[model samples]
Target: MLRVHFTAEDLARVRVAPGPDPMWEILLSLHVLRQRSAAPVFGPWRTAVRATLPDDTRWLLQLAPPVGYSPDFLTPTAGSCPVDAGIEQVLSTPVASLRADLAQLDCPRPDPRTDLLAGGDTAALTALGDALHAYHRHALVPIWDEVRAVVDADRAVRARSFLDHGCEGVLAALHPTISWTRPVLSIESRFPQRDVHLHGQGLVLVPSYFCRERPIMLRDPSRAPVLVYPIARDVRLTCAGRRSLEALLGRTRAAALEVIAGGCTTTELARRLGISAASASAHASVLRDAGLAVARRHRNSVLHTASALGVALLA
Candidate 1:
């Protein structure tokens, strides 16, 4: 069990990332590629993108072992950071810190890139950056649409939970592998069990589409404490599923729900669904009453969103 110790101040400061981290997606996708069997949530992605992996992914494979440390700089303190910022941080790492972090990995002596990083070798760093960019392009970008949908769906669900049940409820129900007990949160980890004390820096709970079964955290945990965990649901939306949705919820209502899932005003929904404003209002009312959609009025316009229940059923 990996236990996270938090203070009252930390509780007050807790935050969850609004979306998936591009850096983490790149790193964790490498882990998925290396495996033949991943969790059900990643199966479709793995199958879709496996053949597209570049041969030169060793740049990532070097650090991301199946079971070992990857450089901590690769996993930033901010739960949501741009890819360039993360890459720069890794490249600018002090020589001592770079080597020290890599030393924890279960790899052989002297990671060749460590020397290049330590020496501030610009040419080697560019090659490294290029390698990452190349890997992401071939492996992740193709399936990024799927990735975004999963992360967005997860965020929507969690936001609903927060609204319905408050902070404690959200934490308590984050994942089946996680247990919340007052100021401490525990997660089952494949790594050697450890305890992390958050010295009042609070914690960022980041939902990840590619983070596998276990919840991951910074080894040092002294700065920007974060816990990256898998999101809810295993089944993803498929073309076949979309085609069958009309069967499940009728053609017009299904179309309305589909548009509503991405968020739309009733007028927008009606126009998109090719129906009158009154027809759109009726469909919206039915969905809302069924607990499958929500509509909130802003001035004269009404915005409709698929409820968590709605998204789950559609998925």
Candidate 2:
């Protein structure tokens, strides 16, 4: 069990990532590649990426084992940073931080690459940057649109949760395995028991397309506190799926769905669809029942939004 202790200030500081963190996607994807048991959701993705594995990318696997410590420098302590900015941070990691992070790896035998990285060799850092760029280009760029779509949808859900119940609500709904109990958030993990206290540093909730099973945290508690959790899987958009959805929901209701994709209250939806408020609510109910939309009560108003699956189906 992993426990994250938070202060009142920390709770106020908690916020979700604006979008997918490219470096984190790369690191977690590498960890996924090392796994023997394949998640049904990622099977197709893994198969596609594996077919084009580049030799240079293998070096990352040595550092980021499937179930062990990965260097903290690989994932910089920034929220929703671009791939280039993230890579630059990794390359510019101070020698002390690099050496300290690498030393924590529980490797049984010494490796030359690890030694060179620990010594802060400029060539080694350059190679690491190149590998990151190459792997991202080969393994992630092709499927990035899908990844971004899924993350955006997940963020939508979280944003609603936050609006409805504040930071606690968002944390409560993060994952089934994670429990938020007032001052502490507990996460079940395969590693030994540990605890992290966010002394007003807060926690950044990062939604990941490649993270699987449970949420992941930086091994070093001293680094910026982040919880990278898996987003809803199976977000593939197709014209056929949209056509089928429209056929099933009919034309006017389908239009309601399209409006809901941007998020709105019942009054806003009724105004946009030029329908009675009751009719708009009824259409939203139908869409919600079909698992295409979610309705959350925010005090006196109920806000409606397209679900991740719903957004994917539409597009």
Candidate 3:
């Protein structure tokens, strides 16, 4: 059990990452590569990557175990950071911090790889960086387009939950294993039990594509506080799902209906569809007439929601 202490102001500061962090994806994907058999969600990815696990990528295996602590240097505090930005942050880490972070990973036996990083060997560091880049490009890029779509969908739902029910609502729906009790938010880490006293820094909630059930957090609290949790494992615009959606509604209309399922304003729908508000409104009108969605006036904005028919169509 992990207890996270929070202040009143902390709740106000709570935020979800607007997008997936590339570095976090790399770190999590490494774990998936090592332990693909453990989670059914990664089965497809595992088969795909097995075809070509480059020899250079093995360097990453030394640090990323199927089950264990991850080096802090690989995970930066920023909500949205490019792969290079994160790699540069790791390279710039103080030798003391690197060694300290590596100390936690000395469990099964002290890994010799730690020495190279601890001693500030630029060659080893550069090689690690290169490995990460190659691994991400080879393994992740192919699926990234769909991956981003899944992540965006998750964020869309989370954002709606935040708007409708506030921070508590967001936390309530984050994951089944996580629970919030006012001042303290408890997470069933299922790891060695400990308490995280935020003191007041609040928490940054990040949604990850490759993360599994148990939520992940920064090992060093002295740094920025963050909790990286898994996005919906089954959420994806698969060829089957896409075809089904299109079958129920035409291709272009299916796209519009899919976005409407998340409950968006006309302006939001327009922006998402890359069409004028008038055009978006016209589509919404069609969906409304077909009993697939309902548009309700809320203040100055019209919010569109998927009706039961729409829900059944998607399900």
Candidate 4:
């Protein structure tokens, strides 16, 4: 479990990135490109893009393997800039930071390019930037439309969640593998267990169409914390999916479903709906019994989230 500890200030500053970060998409997509079974969602994309990747991707592949550490400088600005601007940021990495980042590589293959990069060779840095630009052109630009569409749809869902339930709701609804419990948000990852302390520099949640089942975070803690989570796949949304609240679940019960869809504590549900706590509990009980909602005990409260069926109903 990777636990991110948040201070009060950190909690207040938590936010979703406005849109996809091209650099993040490029880095994580490398992982998918190198995998044989890149999950069902990405298998087809991988098949199509693999044949077109530039031969010199090793400039980045040497650092960003199929799995494990990638230099933090590669994604210096997260969602702050476009690919061209982001590439410049990578090229401008401070010499000290570059050397320190390169030294931490795990089992890096014997490559003179890695040595040149660690020594802050301007030519090597330009080459690295060129490799990134080439890879993005060949692999990401063609599928960029599909990537943006999925990420935007995911953001819409999260935006509704934030409006309904605030930051906690947005955190809780991030991913199934992620859990938000007051001051701590835990994520299941393939990396070794660790904790991140966000004293004041809040976390940036970047939704990536290429991020796989497990969320990815920077290995170095000193840099601004970023959690790149996978966007929902093939979420079937239709006008017919939005049925009248009074029809099947009744007015109040359906209202409860809507609130829970964004995720909230029982007390929060009661407060939002202007109902007594007991009433909220009873409605939640009925919903849980019918598999419309699911609850998890966290600390002293039970956090409720709409189940897949409940989300489908609210679609």
Best by TM-score: 2
Clashes of 1: 0
Residue range 150-228, candidate 1, lDDT tens digits: 5665666666667767777778888889899988898988777899998888888888877877778888655578888
> Candidate 2's residue-wise lDDT over 189-307, tens digit each?
99999989999999899999888889989987768999999875544333334544554458888899999899888999999999999999988877766667766554476767776
> Any runs in candidate 4 off by more than 4 Å, and if so which?
235-315
* Residue-pair clash count for candidate 3: 0
Candidate 3: regions farther than 4 A off? 107-112, 240-315
TM-score of 4: 0.73
Task: Go through the candidates in order and give each one's C-alpha lDDT.
Answer: 0.73, 0.83, 0.76, 0.78
Candidate 4 per-residue lDDT, tens place, 1-315, comes to: 899998999989887888789999988888887777785767767887777667887566667777777778888875636999989988888899999988877754647888888889988887898899999998888766556644654666676577768898888878889898888999997777899999899888898877878787887777888889987665322122334322336788889989988778889999999999999998887776665666655437676777656777799
Please provide, for model 3 over 1-315, each residue's C-alpha lDDT reduced to its tens digit, 9 standing for 90 to 100: 888888887888888887788888888888888885745777877877866889888767768777878888888745667778887887888888887887777456545555788777787788778887898888888877556655665676777678788898888778888998888788897588778887777788888888887787877877888888887664544333444434446666788889998889899999998989998898877776665666645437776767656666778
lDDT of 1 at 15: 81
When sorted by lDDT, best at the front, the candidate numbers are 2, 4, 3, 1
TM-score of each: 0.75, 0.81, 0.78, 0.73
Question: What's the TM for model 1?
Answer: 0.75
- Candidate 2 regions exceeding 4 Å error are 108-111, 234-258, 264-315
**How does residue 105 of candidate 4 score in lDDT?**
78
- Candidate 4, lDDT over the whole model: 0.78
Once model 1 is optimally superposed onto the true structure by TM-score, how far is the C-alpha of residue 111 displaced, in angstroms? 5.8
